[model samples]
Target: MSALKESQHLKIPLKDIEIATNNFQHCIGIGGYGNVYKGELLIHGKSTIVAVKRLNEQFGQGLKEFLTEIQLLSGQNHPNLISLLGYCDEGKEKIIVYEYAANGSLDQYLRRGSNVPALTWMERLIICVDAARGLNHLHHEVGKHQTIIHRDIKSSNILIDNNWVAKISDLGLSKLGLSGLNRSAVISRVCGTPGYCEPEYFSTGIVTKESDVYSFGIVLFEVLCGKLCCTVDHDGFQLSATVVKDYYKKKKVSEIVDPILKEQMSSELIRDFSKIAYRCLHEDRDQRPPMTLVVKKLERLLAIQDVLLKAAESTLSDVIKPAHPLVREGGNASEIPLDISVLSNMRDFVKYNRLKQFALRALASTLDEDELWHLKDQFYAIDVDKNGAISLEEMRDAFAKDLPWKLKETRVLEILKAIDSNADGLVDFTDFVAATLNVYQLEGQDSERWQILSQAAFEKFDVDRDGYITPEDIRMHTGLKGSIDLLLKEADIDKDCKISLSDFCRLLGT
Candidate 1:
């Protein structure tokens, strides 16, 4: 028996499908295979919305495509891939159910329409990252023996959920890629949408994972240009051709970027994203990067974009003023004291006390608005050399007068190690702000916001996804080598040698 037959439990009754979909009353989408209807089902006593795709009667490749999709999607699962809830095959009727995506397809959002607003650069980056992760999983992480090539990868095939999470959909056109087999399968007829299809695949019926990479590159350009792959500008040039021409001709990023994004996005970010997209679109399939490398590049771009967004939203006044003035009215006004005010209110003190017990380096990475403002002058003062970053020597020299005793080189190194998240041996503005906020600003007054920030921070250190964090995990993420034991002991309320999410939240006084 095949894997599909073995997984019989995934089959849904025809009656159930009919009832869930209200007898196909609500048609939400139309695809080449069939019409997608919005449906609702009760599972675990909670209502869950789903998309039901009932195969079109007139569709020529009906049964073959349906079974192929079932075989492929049922065996694989990834956060970025559309989950195959179940399927129904009753006599001549066939239907497949999927998790409902509230935001619908990316193509809808990318194209200009009165119903949808233009997607911001951050949203586009996030959606692209999500899609890239799905493709990477399909190409590399599916299994050692098998690779799946999404033959018809296009903007319309990528669905966006309510939370802006993009899921790759439509596996009917996917081809199973068996490694070591030189000729996986040769198709007599060329498949896939034009413009996004790999040129080599069209010329020669040879399809590989690189083919998907080519489609993904087109999607990237679509995201950047906010135009379709086949779309030709007033000058009669395709989107890809126009972008490449503009890039090589030394056109400014503002010239190539979507007009809507030009004002909001930084030039450097646009250039970097364009370079990656261009590399993916390389004529030589061998020169194109694998999905793993593509994912890494997108992740880096996302990080830089995040920092730029945060910095843009912040100003100096947002930093909380210290209760005791850091600068005196004397000639040494340039020197700002480093002492953070201890909360006198019992509630606030309790919050601070709990927060101080954990390794705060990870939490420090996400500084609130006030913290960002507070670090501006402090960062400038500490970065005495004005080298754009604070080295160990600069840090120690800045605190030389504040310490009762002489600052030790080892102590300065410890400070640097804690805030230098990238292990670059220096603290940048973001790291500096995060460290200062983690040390001084985090308190019980804004318990709700602090809770959210602290939880995110906890998740950052809890790398294993076991809902509990250990000393080793803390040490690995925060570079708190010797201090992990102390943190574990303080935060590990149940003494299980691990910190549960609840324990972590409580420890932050949230």
Candidate 2:
């Protein structure tokens, strides 16, 4: 037996398991190790559904493998990882219980003749990104000095939760990295499913984190092509081989993408996604990008797709009649022309909800006169040429020294464009004040003025209509130069890297 102690709290008595599972009346799935049954257990006076996997006594998993899974699951906690509720080990019976996934495994959806509804390109991308994040966490964030590799990372192992969140399940083949141990390659017996296994690991019986990356690449392509990794073509080439061959032949990405995605997916997105998958499938293990990089690239792709989707929506909205007045015409509000230029900027207007405006006012109220004066001085410092307005070069140069996170040139331009709302390519003191009003003092009597200022501030920072201010959103839309991590540390109460409206209000002592 392993030295790891069994978690008593997570140990469910076999009698309780049998009762919860109704004497194993509902077998939902069968795997190489056991049969999974749907069950319900009462906890803290409340009943919750769960998946109970009972090992087949005749040909079940060995004790060591069972222990390894228990040890791994007992300590692991992530939104994208399957949660182990408890386990049952009584006499000759061995079983494990997991938080039930309502939508089942991803493989069921990817199968050729499956009856499940087709997933859109965006949905597929989101699922893949979610799975990559989970795998990245496993491979890098397990402990301060330890890394874990999910040796079997295929479609069936990725379970979809009720909220469409993809969770990495089935850790039976996982290998934990020991501190100070050589992780260049693990000399283990050949394991993992065919087609998904890394070529190097298969031939040499050596495994590494890169092996998981290789398998993920196969899974990625399977998601893209809507076929299993092992599915063979008429000419006998496996799916991966066929796709790679077609890619080298300069076949258009649209031609290679699954037909179901043709209507909704853009060629640009397919091309970029295909490029990432191709790199992950590199024959040389060293050529495959790490999971962290994979996550980053996927996030960028998703962000781009989101922007494109929004642009398309905005365009469609323009063609349709306005459900509500496009411009609020009242005491001080002007009836702005509903032209193409104005329609194109609808994303900016949609971001300024009442809650965000209130939060901005609350934030502004926290600043004293001295702090407000200091902010003005800081803005003047950026107007280096002593001109009345700050140009893009001035903003970029100022941010280069002041910001903890480096801003790309495009991001700098985006920020400038957000602040310079007049389309004059210059940000005057008025624009500066409008953008940073959330950090300036607001007089008690200036309620109406504060409302206007708050609206401007809300529109300036909340670039996305997600009702939260993320560091990335700030970097893309704000001229404020500071450590984003430090900013998030101060304002993101949930530590989700985004400041919610309530959190923003709370941070301002409102």
Candidate 3:
């Protein structure tokens, strides 16, 4: 038993746990040590939610776990760790209470055939770093505490919260490893899940920080590949370990990545992680990088990708403003001919909403004070309640009635937030004007700026299509000036009845 377990004063009542689990009715899942019941508990004198793991009395091994739980988590406090708030030991019945993770186990999100949106490479790195930090705390960070090792580290043992933060869980099979301990401590217990088990432990049942490192590496591999570490032959009986090992050596690493993720993924990340997995699974065991180094490498990858992530957050219209070379005539102009060959790649447009935002920003940059102030006035005039803050519904109504800003809810929200300099939760006259001027400037910029502006304009108008840009089509979508005459006057070049692709390109400076 752990030393901390010996000093606890609170023992949760069995009846309460039973009631929370609906008399053990739901039976959401079963595990090696016990069956987990999805239940709620009032935490810290406030009504709170939590997932209850009821230890199965039927399993002989569960009895040992019951005791170990008390010992391992008696008074430990770590954010990355699943909190063991309390436990119940009623007669032969035993249950461990854990902080409720709304997102459930990491396996559910990373396992093969999971339909959930695949986590980006950056997200995987984040999860790994968090898990490593948790282990680091257990191993050394916690002040003056003996290092602890989680023997059964795997994807299933990593839980995620509603916000997708990862938490290390299931400490039943953990071991304590500290300095001055028996040099042969690891060699004493050869216990852990097979696929994730450290090879060194098999040779000499001695466990150490490296053992946890090896297990974490396997979990990381499982997450990347989205496959079970151990699996049976497809449409056949289970395959042997020898066969799996041989396959690992013979097959190309890319072939093993989950098919769902293979289509759109970072090949560099996959290859790098594969090499890391190979290091962890090395037969020599001594060749693997330390957990700290592994974490550092992953952090470096995240740092390098921060800009790309931020760039994905905006749209093109947010960047560009279509310029009316002439004022509106209140009538439709001759239709512009579609020059299909001159179309910019539409696929790139859908890839990042941020481009549109950048274009809108560029457009704002090109606008003169008069145009900017006029747009701001339009926004304020349309703001009926004068709350200075705009909602999606209000923005929608404005476009439909041609009252002020004609932008989609998403676009409107983006503009409002951008100009609301004070961030007092509202867009005042200054904000409205600033946003308008921004659009105008984007239209008047050089080619590079126009490219960005064009992307944004297409995005704002291409509400249904994925790519391609049409001047008249956009005018109809935004209903900005109603008739194509005003739009053509804004977009037309060389005094033609219709707008040409080259002329449009000139207008956009693309």
- lDDT of each candidate versus the true structure: 0.72, 0.69, 0.57
Q: Per-residue alpha-carbon lDDT of model 1 for 1-510, expressed as tens digits?
A: 274586688888889878988899999998887899999976546788999999997988877778888888998889899988888888878888888999999999877553798899899999999999999888878887788888898999999998889999998888887753433556676788988887789899888888889889889988988877777665574676446646634745456567898876655456667767766777888667778878977885676566456545656322222232345335332465443221111112223332342335456666565655445666776777777798878877754433332346665576677666677888887666545543212542355777777778788878988888877887776566565565566567688888888777555532
**Whole-model lDDT, model 1:** 0.72
Model 1 weakest lDDT span, ten residues long: 341-350
Report the C-alpha lDDT of model 2 over 1-510, residue by residue, as the tens digit: 342345777888899988999999999999777899999997656799999988877764456557778888889899999998888788888888999999999989888777998788888889999999999988888998788878899999999999999999988778888532436546566678888887788778888888899889888888888777777645464576456647634745566567888777655456667767876778888667788878976886676566456545653332212112233236211122222211122223223432333344334444456545534554555676777788989877754433222347776677677666567999776556444552212422255665554444554567767788877777665444666575566567677888775566444322
Q: What lDDT score is found at residue 391 in candidate 1?
A: 88
Could you tell me how far off, in angstroms, the CA of residue 440 lies in candidate 1 after the best superposition? 38
Q: TM-score for each prediction?
A: 0.64, 0.63, 0.56
Q: RMSDs, each prediction? A: 15.1, 15.8, 19.2
Question: In candidate 1, which residue pairs get closer than 3 Å at backbone N, Cα or C atoms, i.e. clash?
Answer: 318-370
Cα miss at 335, model 2 (Å)? 22
Residue 87 in candidate 2, Cα distance off native in Å = 0.7
